[model samples]
Target: MKKWLIYTFAIAILAVLALQLFMFSTIQQQKNSDEKYFNMAKQEYKIFVPYIPDSLELFGENVPVDHVLVRERLENEIVRNMYWHSHTILLLKRSARYFPVIEPILSENGIPDDFKYLAMAESELTNAVSPVGASGVWQFMKSTAQEYGLEVRTDVDERYHLEKSTNAACRYLKASKQQFGSWTLAAAAYNMGGGALKRDVDAQKTNDYYSLLLNQETARYVYRIVALKLICEQPFQYGFFIRNKDLYQPIPVKKVSVSSSISSLVDFAAEYNLSFLELKNVNPWLRSDKLVVNTGKTYEINIPLSFSHTKLTENIADPYTIFKDSIVVE
Candidate 1:
């Protein structure tokens, strides 16, 4: 009987030990779960959001941001450009290369400084061609480019040349400013047409750009420009931070004049110790393999002063930091 009692006591001790272990494990699991939730809460609440400015201007005209719709629009763009790190950073880099070329042209033509942002909006400072044939930084249609004295031909298209195209854009914008009597409306005219904007103004009996109801592109046009203007000025505020050296530098080139018909552009490029692709890449205006030149026209082609054996045709770097970080060399 004493041996039986001892066995019961041993079994009771084992049950108590098992209960303590299970309780310890349950408490440890709950502690781990609490720590996980706490970390998530910290991350979510710690993010900083930019605030809207009380007042703003575009092309020297005051933005009616006090209005509910206007405030929402500005806030929307700030969020877009702020959070869109890759695209905006690319623009920030490209702007460093292209803005220097375009800014002085705007000043020379008596256009407002703000209009450079218009180019940023139109093409992201790229040599992009629109589906409707609007080409270059300013996205000018072929007919409009021709109307502004740009050569829109098969063999020689000046619209691709940065300086010449920017000058042409200045002319168009200057004319729009003249017709509209306000640079704000002038900008809207660029997206739609000056005729359309003017007709809408007259029919609606309003000259205020902010008050009129425009088609989607024209309506959001000025807002987009303003958004870009703010971001370019304050890149750090919008989360795009870059060193000055990170921006693309403009290549130095020497210009050669071609007056007569060139039967072979390949031979022309070879004369400068450059490949045909190199010549065409720098001067994208050269459309065909051969350049056909008639009387009363002289074309100038720019050749890079120096290049490395590594790159055949120089192009801008990708400028995306995330992509730059991911590259692993073998």
Candidate 2:
């Protein structure tokens, strides 16, 4: 009887342990399933949804962005970028600083204000380079830069020179507009050549930019430009907030024109009461350490007129602190 009681107690204990193990495993499985389901639901919510504009027909013959496929893609990008709130805000802050420099150049060239968005699309207003050797905010390749009257060589690359590059871009845009007879088409041709665009229009028997089939990059190019314009122009609507001080401002500089060869730029800068870095910062086009004077070419070097030695010695407590940070080099 004692043996039987002992055996029964052991059996009961084993049964309880098995039951507990089964219950625990089942609860774990339920928890995993619940987590998976929640994740799946969250992903589903992120799917692209196109904003349907009433005048869809106005964009006729244009690639249908409002269509199910295009809308999904656009919505995906918009949402992904919108949720990336920090980056958008930074872009806004930077634009304020750079637009002043860009706008006047465009206006002087008679190019539309809308074209400012091209730089935003090209380089995000930062000096950027491409795999094919395009460089600067305008992304000019070697041949293109040369064709547009920009000197691109071992020492001097005018593509980094914002004023010169903007001038070149203006000339190109004006020529394109004359060829295409439309600002919209001219803007498109800036990516694809005006002649090629003309041929495409002829082949498609449609003058409408959106109606004809184009390569993926070219097709999306205008829309991307327009999207950037809309977003940057109305930052509050797109949820980008920035302060005036956060925007970049152009530095004050004095211009000194030199027609003769500068044997030593360092000496020349010191003569004018400026540093070599300051001289190079203002005139990025002067590529060489020693300026080989093109006898006919009159080169203009910019010097900072604001920083006088007397003012600094009297007013500035820490001259070391002032020189520590990098001044605008390009």
Each candidate: RMSD: 11.0, 14.6
- Model 1 over residues 1-330: C-alpha lDDT tens digits? 999999999999999999999999888767753354445435544335766678889888899989998888777777787777788888887887688889998999888889999999999988899888888888878888899888888887888888899899888888888898889999999999988998999999998988899998888788889898888887655555454435656666899888899999899889889899888877888888999889987888899876652342235354322222332111
* Winner by lDDT: 1
For model 2, state the Cα shift of residue 51 in Å: 8.6
Q: Model 1 residue 312 lDDT?
A: 23
Task: Give the C-alpha miss distance for residue 125 in model 2, angstroms.
Answer: 1.7
Query: What lDDT would candidate 1 get against the real structure?
Result: 0.80
* Superposed model 2: Cα runs more than 4 Å off: 1-87, 266-277, 305-330
Native-to-model Cα distance after best TM-score fit, residue 94 in candidate 1, in Å? 0.6
Residue-by-residue lDDT tens digits, candidate 2, 122-213: 77777778887788878888888899999877656789888889889888888987876667677778877777899998899876665668
The models' CA-based lDDT, in order, is 0.80, 0.67
The model with the greatest TM-score is 1
